[model samples]
Target chain A: MSVRFWRVRALAMLLALFVGGCTAPPLLTAVLGPPLKPLPVAGRLRRPVYKPYHEETMTYNLVPPPKADWHAKLKALPLTAAGGTDWVKALNENLIKPKPGLDAKAEDEPVMDLDVVLTPKDAPDFKVTYPHKPHTQILSCDNCHTGIFQMQAGADPITMEKIFAGEYCGRCHGPVAFDPASACPRCHTAMPQ
Target chain B: MRQAALWLALLVLATLLPAAQVSAEQGDIVFTRSSKEEGADYPPATFPHYVHRMQFKCYVCHDAIFKMKAGADKVSMDAIDKGKFCGTCHNATIAFGPTFESCQRCHK
Candidate 1:
């Protein structure tokens, strides 16, 4: 047999020892693998090439902020019922000062929660029945919580301004999750003029 | 002398041919399943040969059960008894190496 065959077979056999008593085929050996670079003494497993980061959709379960309520929805109720606070005051107190919490989070995992909303927009008071469970099965929580909104209960103000600016719900409803180029009425329709 | 030269040329061809093959090697194994009983229906992990090679050394899985050729890899519980198949390492680090548990693990 050829000496090259012997050498390749020997090398493959040595490598196979690392896994089990299995031998590798000489044919699989690299013919002229870049120069005979020395395997790192300690970091032998280091890869010679770098791989780029790939992006994918992340999902997270969303629950209505419990401790605090959306001031827009609340304020729309009645001057007295919404604590008789102005829009700015409500934003500063409810949405801005106290942030929202995620309640829970994990790598590649979705947060789940049953939603209960009391909105006074064009509809009556009722729970949103947000698909928290179903959504959790598909999304990552990081996909939702942003620097604009704290990872808590009442951080994201859920404002028409920020939402249209592609902030809170706008992040996905338009760009991240859906197309945002359409007419503005899709999201702003419910807002009081 | 002519015969000796011919053998030498053949030897060179064998060595040179592998180099040629290596240059042509765009080593990435693509896995696609069209069978209604595969992937979604079957979760056997289609076993990406190239992908596995990307992150691992040949020794990680050359095991006695697998050979160079595709069908040549004799993967069976019977061979596993002799420390073949996944049982080779499954015994040391992967799990009980290849026991009653392993037979059912892979076959099932």
Candidate 2:
């Protein structure tokens, strides 16, 4: 065929292919970008073109479990996982044996102290200085009360053993939230300041 | 004769229909259960009309929390604790979940 005639035919064919959504046959190798590679699994590929089910297009901020003390802001707190890490033992240790200073008695008001009630049932009427304003200022409500504190105050029946397990103060002081050892006496003061 | 019979049936049906049929087939959400048993009468503490209107859109609790249309959301105490139905908000913020046992707050 003549050069001019051949060119016209090729142009028309290209136009038809474009309209039909048809492209040049696949080459043994890719013309532009690198050849597609197999993807990871878990990580499964439902699509033929290796479109990943969980390609993890973006990184997400991992929410390290919920803090406990922020919970007490509520009128009452519950006694479940929400119960400030539900670690009464660790909490007792921190409160009674806090870092050298930052002691519970550091606060002026007795009612505002971070001292523990120890036994809610035995000392039902024995309300102690909670030192709430200072703590709340520094931490979220769950820091002391545990996640469940929003439901009730004397809620967890908080015990030293429980606090150690990371229920009350342990929720933060233990490992994830805060290092109970950082200043054991700071929160768990041996004596009132 | 057939037409007459059909007409009679229609009239009877119309009369049988109660006036002002309740839109909420499920009725208003009530916390109390039928039994007087100590733990019986509380069903996740109903989500009142006022509360729903105040906190969120009809869209959120509708299809997601409850099926669209009125009186369709089935909020169970166990489910709320598991973070379903009312649990979506209650566990997160609105209120505590069933897992937390603050008897007076919910039961009362």
Candidate 3:
């Protein structure tokens, strides 16, 4: 065959491959007639399918690696029996220092030393002692009082069901602070004899 | 000569632009309306503009909550307790209310 005929054959093959792959059915059908069923390839004729570019995944090098003695100070800080960071214990021991407000320049807010004893009507046995000292240390009075809870005792009905539903104490307790589900004895100090 | 004058005008405008932006950063507002006339029991309430600015945006309290002009809106302890003026946020619900216990918080 002539070079011109070979060139035309190659061009037709390329066009057929493109039309078969593309979703332009109108053009494909008009040029090549109705679509023909694909023929099955035998074992030897089949080619293995794979991505062309298979280089190893790149490492995130933007963030600098920690020092050799990294986490040494963190390990030195107080930890619970379960091997978790004891936040309250660490705060008391001066292991960690947390600012009450976001702004460093702002003056330290006062901590209400009052402790509220909550006796749920449903579960009278499990009495909860809500200590304002720890809460007020980080948050303002308005953060809870009148918003999440009422200042007056018995005004707000606090139940475990409500707390688990992310209401009242559950707002910070479950999401940010310790999960109340696991730490039951933490809040419920007064157990029935 | 005209180009030189235009350049000088542009330089002046550039300097004034920064000053105009910094004007929004107002100092702490000391409310004296309650304690000014009479020798009141408590001192004037000092509203920390910088502290509130850190938490909220300008539009949160400006125009809608409080007028921009000084002493334009009447602020009284009674009104505050009733959830008006400063009471809107300081009603013990939103923020620490202006109660007898928390007097020094704002008064200072």
Candidate 4:
């Protein structure tokens, strides 16, 4: 065989080894079977609380032992009158002890509220009220200052398109903060007819 | 044959550079102090390292404000109020103070 042929064969084998090493596990699982035990009948049961047949129901009790109840105990504590789960209140009451000077100020305390009216030229009807007080309560001025919005007014070219695309207000609104879709009145309080 | 091997090595290095750059640019890191103590009155404090990193460099707290090792520094609310831990920056003037209302911001 020519030297060129031997070189090509060696290269092909090396490439095959690399690719096979990367993809072997999934391929092996498909050929054989997953090493995991069959899921419990309770897990396999369909939603809407349907009762399974004798064979299906037999494995229901075979489900893994319950996890520690510490999470449940924490959830049971009454933190707020609102009834829904408030992780902050739970953490405060159960986990976090009040430290001197770390106490949050009263809501009625004299705090500056910079409620800016954002009226886009394209959509003059929808005016967004940018509430600064609530945001400033948790975030530093530099969080948004200079990075997202300039300190000067009329400097930020904020558009709905840019916001939806995860720019400007979209940073917190869509993900961890608030639901941007349904929470219209939260921002757009002033709607022109 | 030698030329082919050289080209392969160059290709591998080229792929690694962009991946390294992406991770460096991401900069977002969440620090949780759950390991030190569990089931406290509050959830473990979750420090948004990325949020701070955007304005400040890593060295600002890596060794100066906070120790490099996890669970090394004992941080309390009192410590923060005395301008020790988070209070150094979150003193209302520099950043939002560690007030009662702002407890959830970090506790979560």
lDDT of 2 at A9: 59
Q: For candidate 4, lDDT tens digit of each residue in A1-193?
A: 4676877767765775566555555565565555453222222222223122235564423442343443344356444333333334433354422211222542322335798887877776687888776565444565567767899766898776777877778765553345456457667876522
lDDT of 4 by residue, B1-108 (tens): 885786567444333332111111122223445433333435556665434533343334545577533456888765777788777877655565565435556665
**TM-score of each predicted structure versus truth:** 0.22, 0.23, 0.39, 0.34
Off by over 4 Å in 4: A1-111, B1-108
Alpha-carbon runs more than 4 Å astray in model 3:
A1-76, A81-83, A101-104, B1-108
Clashing pairs in 3: none
Ranking by TM-score: 3, 4, 2, 1
Ranking of all predicted structures according to lDDT, beginning with the best and ending with the worst: 3, 4, 2, 1
Highest DockQ among the candidates is held by which one? 4
lDDT of 3 at A114: 88
Cα lDDT, all candidates: 0.36, 0.39, 0.57, 0.52
Superposed on all Cα atoms, the candidates' RMSDs to the truth, in angstroms, are 27.1, 28.9, 29.2, 18.8
lDDT of 3 at B16: 31
What's the lDDT for residue A159 in model 3?
Answer: 73
> What tens-digit string does per-residue lDDT give for candidate 2 at A94-177?
321222112333432122345434334554333333445434332333223334354455555656577677566554344333
Model 1 agreement with the true structure over A142-172: per-residue lDDT tens digits: 4343443466544445655675776655643
Give me candidate 1's TM-score against the actual structure.
0.22
lDDT minimum window of 10 residues, candidate 4 chain A: A44-53
Per-structure clash totals for the candidates: 16, 65, 0, 11
